[model samples]
Structure formats: structure tokens, C-alpha cells
Target: MSEGNHSSVTEFILTGFPGLHPEYYGLTSAVLFFVYFLTVVGNATVLFLFATNRSLHKPMYYIILNLSVCDILFSTTTLPKIISKYWFHSGAISFTACFIQMYFVHCLGTVNSFILFLMALDRYMAICHPLRYPNVLTNSTILILSISAWTIASALCSRLVIVAYPLPYCASNIINHCYCDHIGITMLACTDRAPYGFPAFLTAMVTLLGPLAFIIFSYICIIVAVSKTAHSQGCLKSLSTCSTQLIIISLYYLPRCFVYLASNVGITFNADVRIVVIMLYSLAPPMINPLIYCLRAKDMRESFLKQFRRITIPKKGQVSALKKS
Candidate 1:
């Protein structure tokens, strides 16, 4: 064992899906890679829509742009290494790299939570207090909120990494998960973890539960406001908007709360089940969020249709040129 704030283990081997059979490695890796592809493509398309389309330059889509960026970044930070691990049989990550991965993983997760909070806030203002929403949620406001989410997440998550980094690790270097995380890394320390683990757990809970409480409250208010509207079509339209956000929220938050709470309360989940739940919460929203936006948001749908026709159909000058050629 080393003397001062140093670990004897230099690197870690990521054991992705402990129960995955040897023969199924290729299948699992292929599936994950495809998912990663979808996640990137979907989020990227949303970003492109925001950049090129002037109509999406409003506050809600601004927050959505933040969400898309967060999802793409979160997926990129955590997925590639594991993909390499399964596809190329390369899971050995250095201790420093592991901690860095943990920081981004936790930090971006918190940012995603904050972005979701902003999304709900936008809805709350627009529906519950329609008159003031125009002044309240502008581009500058979204930018400030987005920047604050990133700054706060970075500041808070840095503590988790800093506190855990100095722990003495004279034990096994095998991390029993897909990627390095505070829990997976800190649990390996050769010292009593209560001093460090509890704080990390509390931080995790704060990041998840805080935004969730607000989201619930906002939606409750939204529901009440919608119910009071005399126009049935207007009520349905507002609900339709909220339904997509709720679906994305449910996908992102439910499994995560269950896992975090269950862990704290000593409810044991199967290792494979836990990992699958984690992956579902982490990966599923990013991939499907853009689809939800396009399918549900009339503006986004119309924008895409407009783009599609512009691309597939040619201008008159181009048609004349083609005929001449």
C-alpha cells in the first residue's frame, strides 16, 4: 500500500455487463453502437434545425438546443470507451482518465437535469401566465440559465472528483460497470467510504430530486391551467405539447430515481438489471427526443416539411438548367 494520497492501482478494467455471455459480446456492442449513432444523429439534427431555421429561434427551442447539446455531449463522453471495450476488447482506462470521465458523466448529467427544469419553466410560464411569458423568457434569459446550469454543475461535481481522488486505492482496479463513475471508482478505495460516499450520494440526489420536484409542480400547475380553459381544442393542444415533454421527462427521471432511491434504501437490484436501467435512462431520451419534437411540435414538423420540400424539389432556375443540360 502506498503512503500518501496516492493509489497503487494505475488503471481500471471496465467490466461491462458482468453477466453478458462471451458469444453475445458482438451482438451487444453492435446494438450499443447503433444506439450511439441514433443518439448523435437525432440530437445533431435538432441542433441543425435551430441553427438554420429562423422560426426556432425562440425561448423554448433555445432551451431545447441546450438539451440537444447536453445529450450529444453526455453520450459522447460515456459511450465511445465502452463501445471500444466491447468491440475491440479494450476497456483498460487509466486512473486519471477514469476520474475525468466520472467528472463529465456526473457534470453533464446535472446539466441535463437543469436543462429539463428550464424546459418545464418555459412551459409553465407560457401556459400558466401567458401574458408575461414573452417578457420573462427571452433568448438572453435562456442563455443565462443555460450558462448557469453548466457552471453550477461543473462547480458541484468537481467536489465529488476532488474528494474521491485522494482516497487510497490499494485494491482491485476492476470497475464493475461500463464507465467510470463516482460510485464505481470510489467504492474501490481501501478506506472507510462513508465520509466520501455519503456526500456523493447526497449530491446525486440533489441533482436528480431538485429538478424533479420543480418539474412535478410545474406540470401540476400546467394541468390545472389547462383544465380551466373553456376551449376544448386549446386544452388538447396544450396537453399535446406537455405530453411529449412529460414522456421525455418520464424516460429520463423515473428509472434514475428508482435506482438511486433503491440503492440508498438497501434494495438490491440485479447487477445486469441495474446496468440496463442506467443505460436506458441515459441513452433513450437523447435518441428519441428529436423524434418527439418533430412529431409533436407543429412548428418543428412544419419546419422539417419545409426543409424536405426545399431539398427534394428543385428551384425553377435549376429545373431550367437541368433541361438545358
Candidate 2:
């Protein structure tokens, strides 16, 4: 077996957007940096809320926490290099490091899909089988399932790296995308890309469509259950509770599915447009998810308020001592 060291290319240049004018590099970098910042702060806040608030220790919140972590990790994996590339004219990435980035990028994305599936399953149980939910999905069970998702995703993503690393690269080392993904890097190989490309595509389909199918079915069941409610208000409330998640799910999945299908099905799209769409689905979810949670979840809002007050408001004794001082 030829090792990665045998490959001619030692590094790769990440072409963030093929059509982006050089003059816009600064602006592009600023936008991406802001996105990265928001993603980190927003998702980190969710983690903080989950960590500090005991009231959030439930099956539903477990999924929220897992999703937040996945979002943060995915953003971290894909955003910084692009930001650096545009900001400092530093697009070079070591071959090994590129593969490492690709691994995390795909792994975390898969984990997010599975976590969303869990969220859908939790809602399904709550709405469709309310009586059995208490016995079915406990905190411990969710934890195990979460760990299994991460483990399986990690294992699956490693295959892409394994298959792509050893291919011979004659000369071309430029990757015409924002990151070193399976498609971007493997396409540069001198040999036939079929062996690596097909399996990777198959894996991507399985990882994305598999969970997405369940999520759709679960929501369908949820809608049916909500529709059967006797009062209109009850139906509205049930649908309202799901609206936030549905928005997030659509943001993450729809664009991705479109891009993948468009590329595979001979539907032509501009390369720059494709990259922008990829960035949106990859980064937007992480940045906006916390806002959705804050708006939709009363308990989380209250907890955030409580935490803010605990930090901002002083004790009476301390206030009096400060006045004396």
C-alpha cells in the first residue's frame, strides 16, 4: 500500500471562492471572522447554559447540548483556515493537516445529523407516544446514544481519509474550494478518482440521507399527532414548539442536499455559488441556533437571565461595603 508520503503534493492551496475578486479579500475575511466569532459565542453560550443549569438535565436538552458542540466543532474545523486564507493570503495547508481537517469536518457534520435525529426522536416520543416517553428516553440512554453517534461518525469519516491519502498526485496541488474536503482533495489525485470518489459519495449519502429520512418521518408523525388534538390552540402550540427546530433543520440540510445532488446529477452551478451555499449551510446553523433557542425556549431564556443577573447584580452586603468604601 502506498503511503501518503509517496504522494507528490506536500501541501495544498485553498481557493476559497474562485470568482472572489482579490480586492474583496479583506471584506470576505472580516465576514468569515465575524461568522466564526458568532458561532463560537452562540454555541458556547448554549454549552454554558447546559453546564450550569441543572433544570436542563433532560433528554431534550441533551440533544441541544450535543448539537451545540457539533456546531462549534464543525465551524472551528472549516472557518479558521478560510478566514486566514482571505485575511493573510495564507492558503497553504500541509497535506497531513488538510486530511485532519477534512476528517473533523465530515465527522462533526455526521454527528450533527445524528444528533438532530435524536432531537426528532425525542419529539416524536413526546408527541406520538407520550405515555412511553418517560420510560423510553432517559438521560443515560441519550448519553449512550450520543456517544455512539460520535463514535460511528468518527469511524466512518476515517475511511475517506484512508482512501484519499495514498493516491499519487503528479503536480496539481490547488484545491478549488474553501476547505480540504474529500471531493476537493481527492479530485487532485493523478490516478482514477472513481475508487475514492464513489465510496466517499456513498458514505456522504448514507450519513446525510439516513438521518434526514428519519427526521422527516418523525416530524410527519409529530404533525399528525398535533393535528389530532381536540383544540386548535393545542395544535398551534405543538407546531410552534417544533417550528424553531424545523427552521434549523432546513437551514442545515436543504442546501447541502441541493448542492450534493446538483453536483452529482449533472445540474450545472457556478463554483463560487456552490462554495457560498456550502458555507451558509455549514456556518449559519451554528451562529443562528443559539438565537433560536433563546427565543423559543422559555426555560433557557429564564436561565440565561438568572445567570446574567447573578453576574451583573451585586449582593446587598457587597453593595453596602462598596458605598462605605
Where does candidate 1 stray beyond 4 Å?
1-4, 315-325
For candidate 1, lDDT tens digit of each residue in 55-172? 9999989888988999999999989999898889999999889999999999999999999999999999999999999999989999999999999999999998888887888889
Model 2, range 1-325, lDDT digits (tens) per residue? 4655445777899989999999999999999999999989988998999899999888998899998889888888989999999999999999889999999988998999899889889989988999999999999999999999999999999887887777787678999899888888887888887767777888888888998999999999999889888999989988998988999889888998887777666798788888988988888889999888876888888889998888767776688899999
What is candidate 2's local distance difference test score?
Answer: 0.88
Residue pairs in clash, model 2: none
Looking at candidate 2, the ten consecutive residues that score lowest on lDDT are 1-10
The alpha-carbon lDDT assigned to residue 323 of candidate 2 equals: 93
Task: Go through the candidates in order and give the C-alpha RMSD of each one to the true structure.
Answer: 2.1, 1.9
Q: 318, model 1: CA deviation in Å?
A: 7.4
